[model samples]
Target chain A: MTPDQILTPILDWLDLAGVAVFALTGALVAARLNQTFVTMAFFALVTGVGGGTVRDLLIGAPVFWMQDPWVASVCFGVALIAWFTPQRWWEGDGIEYADAAGLAAYAVLGSAKAFAFGVALVPAAVMGVVTGCVGGIIRDLVAGRPSIIMRPELYVTAAAFGATLCVIGLSLRIEQTVVWSVAALAGFTLRAAAIRFGWA
Target chain B: MTPDQILTPILDWLDLAGVAVFALTGALVAARLNQTFVTMAFFALVTGVGGGTVRDLLIGAPVFWMQDPWVASVCFGVALIAWFTPQRWWEGDGIEYADAAGLAAYAVLGSAKAFAFGVALVPAAVMGVVTGCVGGIIRDLVAGRPSIIMRPELYVTAAAFGATLCVIGLSLRIEQTVVWSVAALAGFTLRAAAIRFGWA
Candidate 1:
């Protein structure tokens, strides 16, 4: 099979996985704020789908969440999980690790999708960063907190690294599966290090 | 002529007018924050196009600003105006009045476009409010300020009034010109009154 054919199925799972993790973070934020179930669900939904929605819009594609019934269901289900679980369960660096993983995967997925949609290489990479970061930014903004971007974190930088690597790999006609895996790993490693070592 | 045909030409003008006024408000906000010229321009562009961009994305339309050459030009030009002019020039209720006008016109145009794109009635009205308010919401969020939605203003209510009216008129087969004019005027009147009388 061609690279795209092989990557398509994997991308689907990655998309759902990223959405669930992001949604969990969103719900957790609401839970910490003592918000109601409805508010938590809303937060989950927006955080899960915000980045992909922006990417789709910029690429002139149908919105990913609106088209997929399963996406909103996943967000709500994640919210329900967050609502019932004790905050201690999600404490420590676990969620941050998961977030880093999601950021890397999402960045790769975003750039890959953009490239597939005929976007130029640089813009495709930028789309990757946007897809990974915009959701959290939106979540923070609506919650009236300082957004992640305002912090001197390497959050966006990690996403951009993966996204840019993916685009470059695609342009070099590398195998899609290898490119995605390597790029995501590289990004995750960087982000994980940042979280673990307090890298700015 | 069909309502759409008659409204099309007028909608174009309304769109630009709305963009210019909203951009001014956005730039003004950045200026108040003592941001750089670049920040002011960025604020202007986002505030001017944020609502329409969201509307187009939701309705599966090509983003209006991306397709239009003049839209970004208009936003940047307005930013320049805000940058060079004294702050006192934009002080008082003048900008608020202009903002009210833009809000109403934009709401009408947003719903009209959504309706044309075959979105259903209530959702179309929601689109109008989104188009009218999201830009400012984004601006506030990025500026790390409490968003206007947090206030008890009649801002969104007025936009909804205009948007819902436009859709209802369209559904009832009212003349396009009359529908747009009446809807815009109704919204502007309410907003103006709120500004003048300090109505919440």
Candidate 2:
């Protein structure tokens, strides 16, 4: 099998995993605001797919969620979970760590997809950052809160680092698995440290 | 010339007109909030292109702004205009009237594009509404204000009227110019009336 054939399934699974976690955060935010279930679902759907949609558009690919029923189902399932769970169940650094995992995985996935679509490396890295951050921006906007971008968190930068590393590793013909794993780990480390230390 | 060839330039022109107005509103909002020039430009670019960007993504078209420099230039120009103008210059119903005009034109343009792309009629109309209103939604979100969609107004309804009418007319094989003009007129009238009467 070609390298692409081998990598595609793994990337697809990673994409869905990232979507589920991001959708959870979106629904959790809506629950915190006491929004209705409909709102929660909308938040989940948009947050889960928003970044990928933008990435696909920029790369001239079909929007991913529209092509796959599974993506939307994952978002809806996660939304239901967040809606049914007690808010206290999600309180702590655990959710933040999960979000960091999603961010790093998504950043790598976004860059990899862009490169597969023949995007230049730099723009692909930028697409990675966009994919990781845009969903939260949309969620905050809909929820009428100050967006995460407005905060001085190291969120976007972490995604950028992961994406850039992935792009560089791929360009150097590194093993795909090792490149992705290391890149995601680097991003997660930065984010986890930020959360633990309350870094601006 | 083919029908598409004949229509492309006209539609492009209308798209730019819509972008200019939406960008102006975005920049004006930033100005009202006393934001810097950079914020004004960011707001203008995002608001001006946000709706059409969504439409293009959903339909699998190349993102419009990235393919055309004129769109971004117009957005920047409008932002500069808003930034330099005195606050009083944009006061009263004039900007509202301009926004109404843009809403009508963009709604028709968005629906027409969707139809041309072979989207189903109902989804095409919905695309029109999305194209006309999403820019302001993003602008409001970035500015940390309640979006127009949440307000008690005829805003989205007006865009829907124009989009639905355009789709129905095209489906019935009406002349393109007449269909678009009539649809835009209907939307403008509704929005204008809403602005004048403060309709919810």
Candidate 3:
């Protein structure tokens, strides 16, 4: 298969998965805050798509969510789920694992897309880190909490590692599927380790 | 004179003035935090261009700072000034008055640009408010402070009123210069009054 044929389906799935996971987190924040349903949905939408939106704008691409009909619907659906469910239902390591997976996928996707947009290698990697972390940062900001960036966490570092790897792999003309898979898995492993060991 | 002819020059000046004032505020925030020069410069650039950047991205216009040569330079210069000056140099109501004026001008400019981009009336007005307020919102977020939006202040309200007036006037086919001037003056007056009387 051509690189496009291999990467397209994977990227599409990654994009949706990332948005859904982030949206759930956003809605959970609002629910914890005792905000209205509207607020929950708004938070879901912003957090779900915030990073991708920033990446697209920076790379001068048409905004991904604006063009994709399903993204907003997914965010709304996630918000509804969060609203109807108790907060305790989501209390566990499950959400963190999902978020870690999403983060890695998003980092890989962001770097790949940026490289395709003709961004320089370093910036493409930066875009990857941004795509992974900015949504959470924005969520904290709008929710009036300290940004995750201010915390001594391995979150951004894991994303940066994945993004840099993706950029490097692509620059080396590696097989697209292998590069993406390896980059994402490596990042997810790092994040999972961080979570399991309570790494700062 | 053509609407474009009259409005362009005014908008240009407004854009620069708004950017400079906001940049100063951003740099000042960093200075107070005792951050490094790089952080202050980053804060200044983001605050100076944050609102306009969002507006442009939403409206599918080219990101203004990326296109303009002078904007980054101006932000750097403002950061440098803040770096060298005493905190008390920015004390009192002088910066507040300047910020108020900048807020009004930015509101008018944002709405006009959004309308010109063919966004509908209400959203165009929202774009105005976004343009005037988002920079500070971002600054506060990055600085780990409660957003000014959470405060019971007249700040956003004044911007909204001005944006609404600009949109209404443009829709009514009033003279462009008159619409812009009246809109900006009305907003500035509200903000100034709020500052003077400590209006919540």
Candidate 4:
């Protein structure tokens, strides 16, 4: 089936790449908390896909990771890099900007998947929110730190706005690349704004 | 009709109490991470019901938390407690033991629910493990910490052992209380042992 025809995209390539990016974000955060290498890998894997798994389960879709090996494999690779070079990747690395990028990626990916699964508009929007937020939610709870949801930051709001716009665009059958680009930009803009203004 | 006669457990007060206990553990852990009130509540809700949600999805049972508002209410209560008395409840006194107790309660609760949903031995065992571990996994990732699953720790092992004993007792036609006692004790013992011996 064409990628357009697929509901839950096994984004043969982007999915793998997405996993690496999200895992890197997860691993870097865990490293900052002083976790062991094994712990870092676990966090990366869980954070990278936690939201997607929940969305899949809610929609009665096959759990995404169980359907493919690449998700786990990519996370492993990301973890190895993080463990070997935390200082290079995490410390003094404009991490806030990196995290903002990761958030934008997560928002777009989550929105796209939920829409594909035949979730209703509101629920799809919710799923997108969940997908973007849940991994960090899990990470913070385990690390015993404040999570994004608790902070008045723009994290979830940014994701929601992007997801809503994406859903609206898809409903109107707008061009896919155009819809994605707009959503991604909106997410980035909101996150950047929050960070710059030191919004709570 | 017996408790298992109807698949939905809406009237089961024990289940409500069970969710409260589950949320308590989540809240306690979140509090340790210094999460804000909202994050603590969200964590509590997810932690309390996360295992069952995963079990239901895998086994084709209805996700219990979505159908019940009591679980959410209970989690709110736990979050309130954790937030209002963060130091006392999560850090000030005897919090480690509280954590152990929470682990024991959830392990048994998860296993019994799995059995009631007609899961077989291995899947039920897996469900037990999932229930015990997933909330903590999410908690760690969101907190920017490493998850327990990646650790050489005894957490999953202990939960599995407890779940196994619970299943065994059920097969042997033991009393519910007897089985629960056995399972909770087994879980607590293993966890305590791990904490004491520094086992991963």
Residue B175 lDDT in candidate 2: 97
Clashing pairs in 3: none
Least accurate stretch of 10 residues (summed lDDT) in model 3 chain B?
B1-10
Every model's TM-score: 0.61, 0.63, 0.61, 0.57
What's model 4's overall lDDT? 0.71
- Cα lDDT tens digits, model 4, B115-168, are 775666544555566776777776666666666665667776677778778877
Evaluated against the true structure, the overall lDDT of model 2 is 0.86
Q: If both were scored by lDDT, which would come out higher, candidate 1 or candidate 4?
A: 1
| Candidate with maximal TM-score | 2
Global Cα lDDT for candidate 3: 0.87
Interface RMSD of each: 4.9, 4.7, 5.1, 6.9
**Candidate that scores best on DockQ:** 2
Error of 4 at A135 (Å): 1.2
lDDT digits (tens) for residues A1-200 of candidate 3? 64445556667778899999999999998888877665676578778988988998899876676435577678879999999988999989999999999899999999998988889999999999999999999898788887889998899999999999999999999998899999999999999999999999
Residue B11 in model 2: lDDT: 86
- Local accuracy of candidate 4 as per-residue lDDT tens digits, A160-181: 8888888888878998778878
TM-score of chain B of each: 0.95, 0.96, 0.95, 0.80
User: What's the CA error at residue B130 for candidate 4, in Å?
Assistant: 3.5
After the best TM-score superposition of candidate 4, give how far the Cα of residue A166 lies from its true spot, in angstroms.
0.5
DockQ of each: 0.14, 0.17, 0.13, 0.12
